[model samples]
Target: MKKQSIKKTPAKTPVHGSKPALARQVRIIGGEWKRTPLAVLDSEGLRPTPDRVRETVFNWLGHLLDGNWHGVHCLDLFAGTGALGFEAASRGAAQVTMIEHNTPAVRQLEATKTKLNADQVQIQRSDASTWLAKTGAGTARFNLIFLDPPYHQNWLGKVVPLCQGLLADGGLLYVESEFALTDSADSVLPEWMTGWQVLRADKAGMVFYHLLKRQ
Candidate 1:
């Protein structure tokens, strides 16, 4: 027994990928993540809603929700990191369909979805503008639709019109952009969405949130 001693084996350590996980501390400004530091993905040009803007938007729309999230569907277009949609789900939006085109952004979205356990959220990796145009005609039926496209691309013109078809009766759509809707752009909103009023327009830092009502 003294001649041969048992060998102790070292435990295996798990290794992560080449790069560490990227996360943003997103405090709920409105909806369910309110005041909570939600984990969000980060990529170049993928801007998550700032705290102040989220707070303002939520403050404006807080009354509309009225605890009616038990049966509602939401669509988040140009969903860079899927933060908005997830926030909706966390707040009780029945379902969420997230659309993001960028490869890196899409990957981050998938990662975030897993971390948040948001199985109710569906992801579609495609050009939101083209995808909506092809299948969004007269489809307005979602309880909530959000569009946060990249600046300089001018995606609002194409996406906003398409959203009218997907919004459910009296549903709300939030458009996040860098372009301010000056008097010049007022008429730019299509006549089709005449019912969708500009509920609130708030600017925080460089980001802007334009809340619309699918009247």
Candidate 2:
């Protein structure tokens, strides 16, 4: 008896020639861009701030500024997905400068800016530390600054001090970290963080987020 021959199925090739993984998206939680979804790239250590956390942060800021964003200038030092920066721009920030070192992330930011017709938003591809150092003091000042650098890098220690000079008087600094900058008696405030006073703080899962002001 002849053994039955096994048939091999041909592998199916993707129609799009190796399509990249579908980008994850996060939405703008408030302002004119409310509920607008922006694509998020899967870069190493890139964690977009959570929606609930962002809502709480913006709420705190709104209360502090009495819901006025007309003259606000915002700096997003580590703009992973432009979530924070775009949100500020949507809320009527006069200018929003988003710094992202990742090439893909920067391109995505530009695309989103164009899609939104965001003339007030500027995207810069540069290392956050390098940008901070080169920008220096008094050259530019922002009413709000978002610092959500990659975790475990001690980025807060490096850039927090520089932010002081770049921040306008009465400006607010928003930070997201793996560890709490405040509320830990065991944690000594780093010299760079000493000048900042935590205005509002809360934890969401592994993230410790805070809104601070210069002392």
Candidate 3:
């Protein structure tokens, strides 16, 4: 489906050190926390996946999830709003770890966790690339991973291979980028993706979402 744009009045700029206006909320579409609202902080480059895009991604994952999503472990590497991680936890993922370097984002994640009493989710304030490099698959492999880093930073180039290493056998990785993967000059795939294969790909407005699996 072609994504539609929602028109809204421009937000007023906040003064330095002043409290920023409340950003819009992102709602979980399924599982225990279905319809629950998560605050999206007004951080620079903060873009939560669009509702239609997330709905499509989860639909692609539905069959694999089974009934309770038992024994599933997930990682949200960029974790701007903890949306993916929290949604996985709500669906009964054994554990969901969210990693974000932004302090306010981390605080909001903690607040959401506390609000939902989500014991199965862990929030870490750290650079996603550094953390992925430091952590080994043997000690911390995840069955599902979400990668939605700031666009145009070459972050995907650095993190995709690390996520591939961190994924267990048959694991899945979901990525969101500003350009479609088919456009090579615009979106470059890493050379180390020998074990990686695209499972699904779709475009939502200007954003491209992909689901991959490690073979």
Best by the lDDT measure: 2
lDDT string, candidate 1, 2-43, tens digits: 698789999889886798656567664555445556555555
Candidate 1 segments exceeding 4 Å error: 1-42, 182-195
TM value for model 2: 0.88
Reference-based TM-score, model 3: 0.84
Total backbone clashes of model 1? Answer: 6
Q: Residue 199 CA error for candidate 3 (Å)?
A: 0.6
- State the lDDT of candidate 2 residue by residue for 97-130, as single tens digits: 9999999988899999999999999999999988
How close is every model to the real structure, measured as TM-score? Answer: 0.75, 0.88, 0.84
Question: Which regions of candidate 2 deviate over 4 angstroms?
Answer: 1-22
Sorting all predicted structures by TM-score, with the top scorer first, yields 2, 3, 1
**How would you encode candidate 3's per-residue C-alpha lDDT over 57-158 as one tens digit per residue?**
888888755554779999999999988888888888899999999999899999999999999998999998678767864668889999999999989888
Sort by lDDT, top down from the best? 2, 3, 1
Each prediction's number of clashing residue pairs: 6, 0, 0
Candidate 3 all-Cα RMSD = 11.8
Q: What lDDT score belongs to each candidate, Candidate 1 first? A: 0.74, 0.91, 0.85
